[model samples]
Each structure stands twice: as C-alpha cells, then as structure tokens.
Target: MDHLTALENKSIFIIREAYFRFRNIAMLWSVGKDSTTLLWLVRKAFFGVVPFPVIHIDTTYKFPEMYRFRDEYAKKWGLNLIVGRNEGQVEAGMGPGKGTKLDCCNELKTNALKQIIEKNGFKALLLGIRRDEHGIRAKERVFSPRDENFKWDYENQPAELWDQYKSTAAEDNHFRVHPILHMTELDIWKYMKKENIPLTELYVSKNGKRYRSIGCAPCCSPIDSTASNVDEIIAELESTHTSERAGRAQDKEDAYTMQKLRSLGYM
Candidate 1:
C-alpha cells in the first residue's frame, strides 16, 4: 500500500483497538484541519457512523467562523458533539488578555477538558495530535496515559512496536490515543482533499494570510500564505521552512511554554 493508505490502515486499526479496550471513550475534536480529518477517519473506521461522542472544549473566545462551521457541520453530519466550558472561569473574566498564555490555556482549555473527561467518565480520549506539530508532541506515545492529575510522563510511556499497543491503565487514568501522530501536515491536507472533507473557510487564504494552526482567537495568528485550496496548502507545506505552530502566540511567548503547559495538563 502507498504511504497514505498505510497511515489510514494503521489509524483504523488503532481506533478499533481502543474501542475494544476502553469501556468509556470519547474523541476530542478541535474543529481544525487535523481533528476534522480525524473525524472523517472515524466515519471510515465505523462504516460511516461514529460510535462515541466527540468532545470540543469551547473557550468562548474561538473565532466566530469556527463556531458557525461547527454548528453547521455537526448538524449536517449528525455528529454527537459535546461542548464543554469552564463556566466559573469564563464568568469571572478569564481570557487570554487577562492571564499569561499558560494560565489562560490551563483555565480555559486544559481544565475544561479535564472536567469533561471526569464528568463523562471517559477512560480513553482519542486525540488528533501530530508529533510534527511541536517538540513536546514529538514525545507522545500511541497509547499514552495521563494520571488523575493529568500529568503526562513522557519519560516512562509504554512501548508499541509492530502495531501492538498497550491500552491498559489504572483506574481514573485515561489513555490518549493519537492515531495520526506520525502524519505530516502535507499528508493531512492530501487526505482531506482526497476524502472530500469539509473544513473551516478561515483556513483558506484571504488578503495574503491564512491560519496554519487554529486555537483561541486572541492567541492564534495567521501566517503569510496565498494558498487557498487543499492542494495549494500541501504544496506550501512542502516548500515552507516555518513550523506550523509559529503563528501560535502561545508557543512564541517562551521556549518551553508549551512543555510547561502540557505538563500541567494543557492540551
């Protein structure tokens, strides 16, 4: 099989394995390219029907277009979309401008996710994170486990050789399944194009700028690009030297900012 096909096969197998191993499970959908592509993969894996609920941590500071697209598509596709928000923090004037990037992320994104996982009692969370996205993500395992406190032990993850993954974890601990960890940004675009997946229009370049990676509106910035279509995005990635997360202000605040946030249970 070709590389793309191979990746799809591996991801399908991993999804099925996670389904069998975990009694309570859910997948996180950020409504970005990666997660949208992962949503398509879920349909493919389950024969056009997703078995589990898709979780989205709504910081309430997301781009208006993102929510519009999300609501439209969720209804169009008949998705089991579950939105989680930290009402207390949002009500108390918590936002990117009020706190540091790490603090804002922890309060709005990570803590919200943690509460959702706990409320739903999900034993596994399938994420669409890729290793190439950042340095910290590069150290993730296919079936990585996070403690009740949401600490990721990058140094002591389980082994997964020859397609055999370890899905077991202790009580109250959730396994993070990253099926597309090995895929490059180009592969994701190509797959999305081939599969005819719907995506947020904000990704398409407008006035010589397009968002390479999306997050909270205040923190995420657009990169200089003229690529308006999926094929053009693939071509741009092939020639671009800048990292995908470069436009993300949070990652630029400090060298180890992401690492620190992630260690403290930020996604």
Candidate 2:
C-alpha cells in the first residue's frame, strides 16, 4: 500500500478498535482541518455511519465563520453533535482578554470538557491530535489515560509496538484515543485533498492572510500567506519552514504552556 493508504488503514483500524473496546465513547470535533478529516475517516471506518456522539467544547469565543461552518456541517452530515460550554465561567467573565490565557483555557475549555464527559459518563474520547503538531503532544500514546481529575501523568506511559496497544486502565479512568497521531500537518492536508474532505474557508488565504491553525478567535491569528487552494497549501507546506501553530497566542504564554495545557486536559 502507498504511504497515505497505509496511514488511512491504520487510522480506520484504530478507530474501530476504540469503538469496540470502549462501550461509551465520543469524538472531539474542533471544526478544523484535522478534526474534520478525522470525522470523515470515522464515517469511512463505520461504512458511512459514525456510531458515537461528536462533542465540541465551545469556548464561545470562536470566530463567526467557525460557528457557521460547525452548525452547517453538523446538520448536513447528520452528526449527533453535542456542544459543551462552561456557561458559569462565561457568565463569571472568564475569557482570553480577562486574565492569563492559561487560566482562561482551563476555565472555558478544560473544565467545560470535564463537565460534559462526567455528565455523559464517557469512558473514552477520540481526539484528532498528531505527534508532530507540538512538542508536548509528541509524548502522547494512541490510547492515553486520564484520571478522574482529567490530569495526565506523562511520566508513565505504556508501550505499543507493531500495532499492539495497551489501552487497559482503571474503570474510572478516561482514555483519550488518538487515531491520527501519526499524521503530520502535510499528511493531513494531502489526505483532505485526496478524500475531498470539507474544511472551513478560514484556512484558505484571504487578503494575504489565513489561519494556519484554528482555535478561539481571540487566541488565534492569521499568517501571511496567499495559498488559497489545497494544491497551493500543499506546495507551501513543502517549502515553508514555519511552525504550524506560530500564530497561536496561548502557546506562547510560557515555555511549557502546551505541556501544562495538555496535562490539565486541554485539547
């Protein structure tokens, strides 16, 4: 099989395995290129039917385009979409502009996810996280476990070799299943193009700027680029030396901000 085909096959296998192993599970959809591609793969894995709920941890600060794209696609695809939000925090005036980005993320994103997961009693969550995206994510396993507090102990991780994974954990522990951990930024774009996966046009350049990474509107900024099409984006990825998340503001708050964020259950 070709490289892309191999990746696709492995991801499908992982998705199937996660569904079979975890009786109650959900998938996180960030409405970004990677997660949308992942959602597409989930459909293919289950023969055009996703078997579980799709959750979006809404910070309520995302761009209007993102909200529109999410609502439109969620309806069009017939997804069992569940939007999670920390209404109390938002009412209490927690946001990117109010305090440190770390604090805001913890309040809006992490705690919001915690509420939904516990309320729904989800045993596992399929997240679209790639190892190459950031240094902290490189330490993640295909099935990483989190405690009741949603804290990850990165110091101890099980080994997986030759498609064998140790996904066993305490009954109360939550598993974060990463099917696309092996796909890089370039691989994702190529797969999106090959599969005709639809993404929000925010990634496409407008006025010589485009969002390389999509997140909360206040935390994410646009990059200087003119790559409006998928083909042009692939070419840019091949030639550019810039990091994919160079425009993300929360990541720059501290030297280990990403680590801290992920450790506390930030996606």
Candidate 3:
C-alpha cells in the first residue's frame, strides 16, 4: 500500500493486460532508465520470462555505450531483441546534421519504428513513455490508437475515465499502450533503487557531467551533475529544478516539435 509498491502493482497489471489483450505485442527498450525499468516490470509481470519481443529503434547514431548496454542486457535477460532501422534513409544521408531535427526524427526514428511495427505485424506496442517526461506526452492515453498511416488523432483520442481504457484499434494499425505513463521521472529512479536495476554509466556523472536524457549522441547533451549513483541521483532530483529532458535537442527545435512528431506517430 506504499507509494512505490502501488506504482509497481499498477504497472504490472497494465503490462499483463496489454499482453493478454494483444497477443501480438512488443515492448520498446530504449536502453534508457525508463524503458529498462519497463523491461523489469515485464519480467515481474510474466514471472521471469518476457513472452514477446523487445524493440530498439537504432538510428545508428547512438552512443557506443548504449549499444553495448543494449546487447548485454538483451542476452542477460534472454529478450527477443528486434533492432529497428530505416537502412535506406540512413544510407541516403538522413540525419540530424543534414536536416532539421523534425525531419531527422521522422525519417530515422519515427519512420524506422513505423516500418518495423508494420513489418512485424505488432498489434500493440508497450512504450515506457511517462507524461512527466514531456508536455506533449501529457496528452497520451493509457491505450492510444493509431491509423493505418501511423497517424495519431490526439484531439479525438478515446477517454479513459477512472481505469477504463479503450484498447481497441483498427485492423490495419496498432495500439500504443503506456504502462508506465502514470509514473514520474523520480518514481522511475526510486523504482530502480528498490529493484536494484542496473544502468549504463552514461547516467552516472563523469567529470561533473551526466546525461539526464539519452538519445542519439549527436542530439543528446550532458547536464552538469556530480550525482554518480542512484541514491545521489534521487537526492539531486529532489532539489533540482531541471526538466528531465533538458539534454534532448529535438524538443528545443520548435515549440510544437514534439506535438507534431507524436501526431505523426513518433514515440
């Protein structure tokens, strides 16, 4: 009945519900603290075995450490790891450096995710997105649906009053289930502490700098922090006034960048 336990139990219920409601489902593993925590919740829900695939939409621009952490955990946890990429775009010189942040994200990250989901016929995808992470994400539902074109009708999304959720989606598209949507950034770190979750050193400070949010290396900057461990991070978060994604470059591209991206089916 405590705070952390309550969060865990709800997340477990959501994970299991998504699994049973959509048998052809997968979870996104961003190799970040949030998504990694989602992976932990999956194991807890299914009793040590993740019954579905876990996806990493590799833009081919991520930090080398991220890739190493991904591979290590995928094997250590025995995950069916599916690496998603838009090889053609990558080859055609589509990237944050060559184009606008929105364009780059759509081509490399959003389109890549869309292609993989369609190719694999995933009826539902469990994302570790939390509302507290971004302003646009605050508009998300526990069970959000997309059209065949991978477009989200954010304005007309089905309401989820109380615990009721609209899990139904069209035959040609899928649902994006947010199991950890209700959890906050601090909640994630606290859960990590309680669960003894392992994190990549990228989150830990080295030379008074640590990444608060990680994406492709080119777009992710480090914050000034000396919080080298989970306990220190939790303590820092208590007194810090920084946004969780202050290091992400994409959000700074435009005031409505994230909203537009989500509308276009970006995760």
Give the winner by lDDT: 2
* Per-residue error (Å), model 3, residue 66: 0.6
Worst 10 residues of 3 by lDDT: 246-255
What local lDDT does model 3 show for residue 78? 96
Q: Which has the higher lDDT value, candidate number 1 or candidate number 2? A: 2
lDDT of 3 at 82: 96
* Model 3 agreement with the true structure over 85-141: per-residue lDDT tens digits: 999999999988887877998999889998988788999999999999878899999
Report residue 241 deviation for candidate 3 (angstroms): 1.1
Score candidate 2 by TM-score against the native. Answer: 0.93
Weakest lDDT window of 10 consecutive positions for candidate 2? 249-258
What C-alpha lDDT, on a 0 to 100 scale, does residue 251 get in candidate 3? 62
Model 1, range 176-252, lDDT digits (tens) per residue?
99988888898899888888899998899999999999988888889989999988998899998988888884465
Judge candidate 3 at residue 242 and give its lDDT.
Answer: 75
After TM-score superposition, the amount by which residue 117's alpha carbon in candidate 2 deviates from its true location, in angstroms, is 0.7
In terms of lDDT, model 1 sits at: 0.89
lDDT of each: 0.89, 0.92, 0.91
